[model samples]
Target: MLPTTRGDFWAEITQIGMDRLWMQRFHVSLPQVSTVASRPGRRSIGFLTECNSSPLQHCGLNVLSGDIIVNKFDLAHHRSGADYHLGTMSLPTDELDTAVEVIIGRELLKSPDQRIVHPHPALMSRLLKLHKAVGQLARDTPDILERPEVARALENELVHVMVRCLAEGASADTTTGVRRHDAIMARFEEFLEANPDRPLYLTEICAAIGAAERTLRASCEEHLGMGPIRYLTLRRMHLVRRTLLHSDPSKVTVTQVVTDHGFWELGRFSVAYRMLFGESPSCTLRRPAEQPNIHLSRPSSLTTAEPRAT
Candidate 1:
């Protein structure tokens, strides 16, 4: 178990199942990253950034007081703990994965083939301001976790706000090449949300966003940290999972819900969803009367669903 400080706001571990995934939450009275070890794998959403710390990723969105960072980690190589208030969400690892996939798909327009390798320091600086806004919100807003819907809404707003901020920053850039790159990402995200239920091909996405494959891919790699297809798939799966959990199972079949959310391959969707959430789609459908106790790695304040066993 990772160490915790006395008086630090935290959540008890809610569930630990077959897959090596868990959930927890913490408040940001004092900044720390003690929960890093729990996610031994890379590509996990380890923490979201808040206003207290620097924006660690390549894009320069300001760190707002109530803004969340939503950190994903590849535990294989731990980046140094850059100065930032990393907030952990209480959703299961799989849920986070699914959410990230959905977010990238719905929010990012870049292509997988385009690859940008280097980090942009200037962009990183701008992101810091957004982080600060989020942090301020967190500090001012009391009992965010108690109101799950409100909390989720705030999280979503933060993401959209950051995307807009990124676009603004890109517009200010003197280099037409970089501005075009930013435009592709912006347009891509817009296109994705508008067509969440449609099949998204790489060529279609790039064409719609009016970006070359290489440039779009590089922007995605640099800003969003994912390729196009994988990100879209994940986003679809996440939406499916959320629908399963929140909707009336009696009114919706698993296949219907998944397909409606843009998941065409049933078998592949089932497998990926299981790997991320630690349970089958059917599990989410079955509305249990009692919530199960579970364990999560991060602090307790930033979670949505109740953790369960596989």
Candidate 2:
């Protein structure tokens, strides 16, 4: 397994082969734990077994001192300036959303906006029961986790319980409270998700979101760290990547996929795709057909310790 640590923060993590689940045990005695970078399509469910500090801030949201920590996949950091211990598992987007909808209700998953849930007393009580059960299983029946059926069953239980606890704890106001920038971003994301095949410019986005050009630009830069146009470009590029990854190269070409996604300028498109995904568009297109053992590497912009799965 890869070791990730700095100062008082350290963790040993393992990925379950090609599956999206990751198990990690991390310990820290500092005021704050460093933000660990991760890809965008997952969520982290952590158990805070030990903590003697104030509320924790994760991804700019507050995580109350509790038995569970649940947040969407993003750069994570502990706001506390004191010591704490954490046990965490990562689940992919679809798994998380489905579990949440089934356990709590579909209302929570309908909003694509990221949220931090402070588990209520009732939820925490239920989590404690799950934590004991899973902890014992991890320790004494390790082989059971290796079984796909067993692991999936446990994972489903964990995801459902976590979401149920979190949603119950959250107040209606808290769940519906969208900050100014977050609201703007949500509107933009909704627009893009609905119109993935539609081409749009900055002025068009501003009008759709009902924000002025300057306001939209500032909000995107502040929340997403990019202007609206750049953000749209990157989103479109990701859509292209997804299409290429899943398409049959025998019947489809990289150029055709890009054109279908409204990427008119092929030259610049190739460069941007490479920079974002660390591979050329053609490599991605060929990947499905070739079925190479090595997949395209992740972008270098993400920082993390060595990812070792035992």
Top-lDDT candidate index: 2
> What Cα-based lDDT does every candidate model obtain?
0.47, 0.58
| Predicted candidate 1 versus true structure: per-residue lDDT over 203-298, tens digit per residue | 988888888888778866654555667656655665676678777877879988888887788898888777766678988788653353432333
Q: What TM-score do all the candidates reach, one by one?
A: 0.46, 0.47
Best by the TM-score measure: 2
Query: Scored by Cα lDDT, where does model 2 land?
Result: 0.58
lDDT of 1 at 75: 18
Candidate 1, run of 10 with poorest lDDT? 72-81
Query: Which residue pairs in candidate 2 have backbone atoms (N, alpha carbon, C) closer than 3 angstroms, thus clashing?
Result: 2-308, 14-309, 31-80, 31-81, 31-82, 57-79
lDDT of 2 by residue, 1-310 (tens): 1111223232322223214455554444434324355567876666665444444544345555564555543444343443454556677778777766777556563334435455677667666566556555554455666677877776666666667765665532233423565567667766876777667888888898887898777666554445778767766775787788789899989888998887888999898777666779888888743332232222111112311110
